[model samples]
Target: METEPSAALMSAIVTEHFVLQSGAGTTVSEALGRSSLYLSALSSSLIALGFAAQTPGLLLPFAAAALPTVFVLGVFTMVRLVGTGVQNMLYLSGISRIRGYYRTLDPEAARYFARWGAGDGETDDALGSLAVRGGPMAGLFTAASMIAVINGVLAGVGLALLTYYVVTDHHLPAALAVGLVAMTAGLAMFFRYQHRCYLRVQR
Candidate 1:
C-alpha cells in the first residue's frame, strides 16, 4: 500500500516550485539587464567616436582605444548571459519536476500540464521547442550570440584600422581582408565557448 505525503512535505514542495519559478524569472531579467547595459555602453562609445572623428586626426586614435574596450565588455557580458541562460534552464527543470510530481499525485492533472508532466525527455523537448527544430544556427538567436557577433565586428574593424594605418600604409583591400579573417575567427571562438558552456550544463 502506498502512503500519502504529509502536509508539511507537500507544502515544502509547493514552496520549492514557487522559488524555482522566481529564480528562473530573475535569471531572465538579469540577462536582459546585462545585455541592455552592454548595448547602451556601446552606443555611448560610438557617439564619442563620432565626436572624435569630427576633430582633425582623432578618429583612428579614439577608435583604437575605444573598440578594444567595447569588445572586452561584450565578451564579459556574453559569458555572463550564457551562465544566466544555463541557470534559467536548471530552474525550469526544477519547476517541471514539481509539475511532474503533481501529476503523480493526480494523474489526470497531467493532461492539463501537456508535455510538461510527461517525462524529462519530453519536458526538454517542450522547453527547446521555442528555439525551433534547427540545430546550432537556431541557438544563434540568443542574447549571447548577439553579443558575440557585435564583439567580433568590433574586433575586426579595430584591427583593420590598425593594419591599414600601420602595416599596409592605408591599403584598403588588404585591410578589409584582414578584418574579415579577424571577424570570422572571433565569431568562431565565441561560438566555441557557447558550445562548451552548454556541453558542461548537459553533463
Candidate 2:
C-alpha cells in the first residue's frame, strides 16, 4: 500500500507556508508606504521650486538647485528599479529560483505562508493574491519614480536658464538662493519624519 503523509507532516507543511505568505504581505505593504512618502515629498518640492522659477525678477541658483534635484532623481530611479526586481522575484516558482525570490520578499510573508497552507482558499487563488499585491505596488513605485525624474530634470533646466540672466548683471536677485535654502530645510524635515515613522514601525 502506498504510504500517506502523516497528520503531523501535513500540519507542519501548512504552517510553514502560512508564515511565509503573511511575512511577504507585510513587507510589500511597508515598501509601498515608504515609496509613496518619498514620491510625495519629491512632488511637493518640485512644485514649489517650479513656482518660484516662474516669477519674473527672481534670483535662481543654478548649481545649488541642480545638485539636490539630480541626487533625488537618481535615488527615485534606483527605488523603482529595485521595486520591479522585487516584483519579478515574487512571481517565479522554480525551487532554487523561488528560494532566491523569497530573499527579496518580505520575511514575514514567508513565515506567514509557512504557517498557513491555503489560508482558506484554493491553492491557485492563494498564489494569485500574492501576485496581485506585488504587481500594483511595483506599478505605483514606477509611476512615482518616472514623475520625479522628469520634474528634477525640468527643475534643473529652469535653474540653468535663470542663472544666465542673473550672471549678466540682470542684477542677481535673492529669491533663488532663499528658495533653495527653504526647500532644503523642508526636505530635511520630511526625511526626518519618514525615518521616525520607519523606526516606529520596526519597533
Candidate 3:
C-alpha cells in the first residue's frame, strides 16, 4: 500500500529546496560582483594609461607594465565566472528536481510550478527561458565572453606596443599586423576554453 511522506522527510526536502535556490542566487551575485571588480580595475588602468600618455617617455613604460597585469586579472575573472555559471546550473537542476517531487506529493502542485517538473521537456524549457539558447554560439553572449575578448585585445595591443617600441624600428604597419595576429590567437584560445566549459555543462 502507498503511504504519504513522513513529516520529517517533507521538512528535509523543503530545506534542501530552499538551500539550492539560495545557492543558485548566490552564484549569480558572485559572478556579477567579480565582473564588476574586473571592469573597475580595467577602467582605472585605462585612465592611468591616459595620464601616462600625456607625459613624455611615460606612455610606453606604463603600458608595458599595466597591460599584462590587466590581462592576467581578466583571465582569472573569466575562469571564475565560468565556474560560477556551472555551479548555478547545478543548483537550478536540484531545485527543479525538488519541484518535481512536490508535484508528486500533490498533483495540483504542477499547476503552480508548471514550467518545472519531472519531465525533461518541462525542465529544459524552464531553464531555456532563464538562459540563452543552447548551442556552440551560446557561450559567446556571456559575461565571460566579454572579458575574454577584452583580454585578447589588451594582449594584442601590448604586443604591438612592444614591437613598435623595442622589437621593430617603429614600423607601424608591421606592428599593426602583429597585433592583429596576436588578438586573433588570444580570442581563439579563450573561446576554446569556453567551449570546453560549455561541453561540461551539457553533460
lDDT of each: 0.80, 0.46, 0.82
lDDT of 2 at 172: 43
What is the Cα root-mean-square deviation between model 3 and the actual structure?
2.4
Best-to-worst ranking by TM-score: 1, 3, 2
lDDT of 2 by residue, 73-100 (tens): 5456445544543443343222223333
With candidate 3 superimposed using the best TM-score fit, by how many Å does residue 80's alpha carbon deviate from the native? 0.7
* Residue 49 miss distance in model 3 (angstroms): 0.9
Model 2 collision count? 29
Residues 1-203 of candidate 3 have per-residue lDDT tens digits of: 66899999999999998998899889989989999998899899999999999999999888988888888999899899888877777787777777767777776887876653233643364356466556678778877888888888888888998898899989999899999999999889888888887677657
Give the winner by TM-score: 1 or 2. 1
- TM-scores of the models, in the order given: 0.90, 0.42, 0.89
The best candidate by lDDT is: 3
